[model samples]
Target: MVVRIFGISIVVTVISLVVAYLYGGVEALILCAILGIFEVSLSFDNAVINATVLRRMSEFWQKMFLTIGILIAVFGMRLVFPLAVVWITAGLNPVKALDVALNPPADGGEFFPDGSPSYETALTAAHPQIASFGGMFLMMLFLNFIFSQREITWLSWLERPLGRAGKLDQLAVVVASISLIVAAEFLTDEANRSTVLLAGLLGIVTYIAVDGLGSMFEVDEDDIDEAAASSGGGPSQLAVVTGKAGFFLFLYLEVLDASFSFDGVIGAFAITSDPIIIALGLGFIGAMFVRSITIFLVRKGTLDDYVYLEHGAHWAIGALAVILLVSLKWHVNEIITGLIGVVLIAAAFISSLVRNKRLAPEADAEVEKSTPVS
Candidate 1:
């Protein structure tokens, strides 16, 4: 599985480079590789979380994740989403925006010769908006992690109550909505309040819709474990339910992937505005790494061994949420976001090692007692 995953990553990277070369030649290839590494480093936690969810999914869904899901990730979210945001906020025509993105200014001085805006300039001009999107998006993701970890199942019980209040309690949607309104009041120099509001609404709505779909489609964890135990290394009953279960799992995975990508995608604006470059570079490479990491975790059963890893990732995600919320009121650097996640996960990993070390002696003693002759 590791070898296969590596092969897949190589194939995807080569294909991305080929596609980029056809579009923008050597420059695109170089940009893709660089951004890909940056994205991968920043999103290792994303892979871990993905593995947890993916393991619960059916094999068919896993295949879908690699297929149609990748298209949505690469084209729809990474490419079109950012471009759409720029267009809506900056008031640039979509075609013109694409043109400018494709052909950046010569010296980064002037993007357009006819006094029209350049892609770089447009991207710079849209920094606050992108920041706003990322800030709110990350906050939502962090909140969701907190909600998930708590004993309280908000969706299971409070779903109807929250619905009764005629309001959305999902943190991401709320933050995005509030950010849109705030940006409307203070940052309306570019996009209309409605556009920002629409964007926020879309983020929230997509999350809820996807989440609901996931709930309906998810498999019972107890059932899977029981089947696995009974099968005893043979094909488990999970294989039988793989089709429908896998589809739902795949959908959930994609949604989670999108949530993780939000900050990175918006941050890419800080580097460059070529949608193709952003999509091919970040999208292809990032997704490939995510896939490889997921396979590694699943095969190794790392989650079972390092339970704290998930806890740490969730806490880091929570911190990221707060950072996103604060970003609404201030200028929060993207590097800070990435750093916080790294620190949280690193701490968790170290703690896990410490815990294992402390328990090793007791475990060895118990093993010696069990082996009487030995």
Candidate 2:
């Protein structure tokens, strides 16, 4: 498996290099490598969650995710998303925006010559919007996890009386939409407010629509059990359920990844405006790392060993979501957003290790008791 994985990586690397060479030579290669490292380091949490999900997927879907999913991530989110933002905000034609990104205006010691702003300046300029997007996105993810994990008791209706409404999802959608509209109306300069509002609405609406669609297609646990019993296999009914569960898991993983990439892609304006570079560099490298991490988690059964890693990643994602929302009003640095996630997850991992160590003696004693005295 290691050899196969390495071989696959080599093929991917060679292909990426060839594309980079044709497009921007050494510059593209260097950028891709850097972005790859950045994405991998910041997204370790993503891998853990992805592993948990991937393990549940059918082999067919797993292959699809590895192939089609990678393309969507690389081209759709990383490349097109940023260019779309520029086009929407700056009113630049898509082709021209692509050109400007590829060949930015000369630097005048103030900003890029094509009237494009510097990385820091652009990030500062758009900071509020980025924050709002990230914050709300993460918050929704956090809430979803919390609600899902809670024990649902049919008779315990003490907390909030609206449980029978079946409208929490709708409420979420409406609130997010109104929030964006209101923010656009009052929170920003007239020229830029429309852009920010539209972006926020886009994120919220997109998430809701996608999630809803996924739910519609989801196979229930009972259904999975029936299917498994019908076919008598060593994997068992529970295994089938877990495999089907992977689909939703993969969907959530993709959504989470998309949310994380939003800021990073926007942040790339700080490095270069060329959409090609942003797409080629960040997209290629980031996708590769995501894949590598996914494979690692799947193979090592890391989730079984460290139960809290997913919790930590989700929490980090939640923090990011909140940061994005707050950023709508106040500027938050992407570097800071990335760092906060890394630190939180790293702390969780260390804590998990410590807990495991402390439990070692107890676990060993239990094993000894179960064994015949020798």
Candidate 3:
């Protein structure tokens, strides 16, 4: 199962490495490898979070995530999305943007000899809007998770209080809205304030629309049992999603992937400005690796095994959202961003180990009592 899941990722990595070496010699190969590592480290938490959602999906949609989802992640988010951003935000046509992306400015830097910004420059220039939108979307996700009254929590003291406050209806939305307002009002300059606000608002709206639709289509437990009874069968353990629910879920995941890549996409330029190379690293290898981890976790029921894993992922997301908002005011290193997530997840894993050890005796007691004598 592991080999089957990683087969595609292995194939993509070899192809991308060959392509990268061909594109810009050994240097390009090295840069591509670095970006792959960078993305994987930064997004390990993404896999944990994705597993929480992906486990509920049916087998068909899981396959969809492996296939069509990869195409979208590779081409749509890694390739066309950047072009679209350059087109809309930079006021360049799609073709013009592609041309600029493909061919650097004559001087071989982020500016033309005539003093106009290069393609990389244009994309980076739109950082405020990108950060605001992606940050707000992720902030809402993190807030929703923290406020959700889940049975399990890693930091019981903090999460318990937050969950209690979550009883206030629409608290996530109200808090997210206020965060967006504060960010736009204080973090952005006058020239970019309205644009930032608009982008941030759109982020919130997009999250609500996608998440709400997915939730609306989800089958209730009682309904699932009733349907099974009508068909003359016992209640199935699995609530396998299909049709509209699956479709919206797939859409929601893609949006989530896009949101996570905002800082990553921008950070790639700091290493290398070649979009082809970025796509080779992020789309081909990095994103593939992340998804592979997600599938492994789902197949293994890792979330159930490690009780606090989901909480750790959500906290990492909250930290990233805060970092993104902070970036609007001051630059934050990509290394710093990635390290924080890695550390949190590692700590969570260790804590889960401790929890298992503590419960081992109790689990043994229960098993011994239930056993029958010969």
Q: Pick the candidate with the highest TM-score.
A: 3
- Best model number under lDDT: 3
lDDT of each: 0.68, 0.65, 0.89
Task: Give lDDT tens digits, candidate 2, residues 76-131.
Answer: 88877666656655666788656655554465343565566433343346555655
How are the candidates ranked when ordered by TM-score, highest leading?
Answer: 3, 2, 1
lDDT of 2 at 275: 62
Worst 10 residues of 1 by lDDT: 147-156
Could you tell me the lDDT of residue 199 within candidate 2?
66
lDDT, candidate 1, equals 0.68
Residues 311-369 of candidate 3: C-alpha lDDT, one tens digit per residue: 89999999999899888889999999999999999999889999999999999999999
Clashes of each: 1, 16, 0
RMSD of each: 6.6, 6.0, 2.3
Per-residue lDDT for 70 in model 1? 77
lDDT of 1 at 255: 67
> On lDDT, who's better, 1 or 3?
3
Model 2 alpha-carbon drift over 4 Å, by segment: 14-28, 107-134, 147-202, 212-222, 228-252, 329-331, 372-374
lDDT, candidate 1, at 193:
54
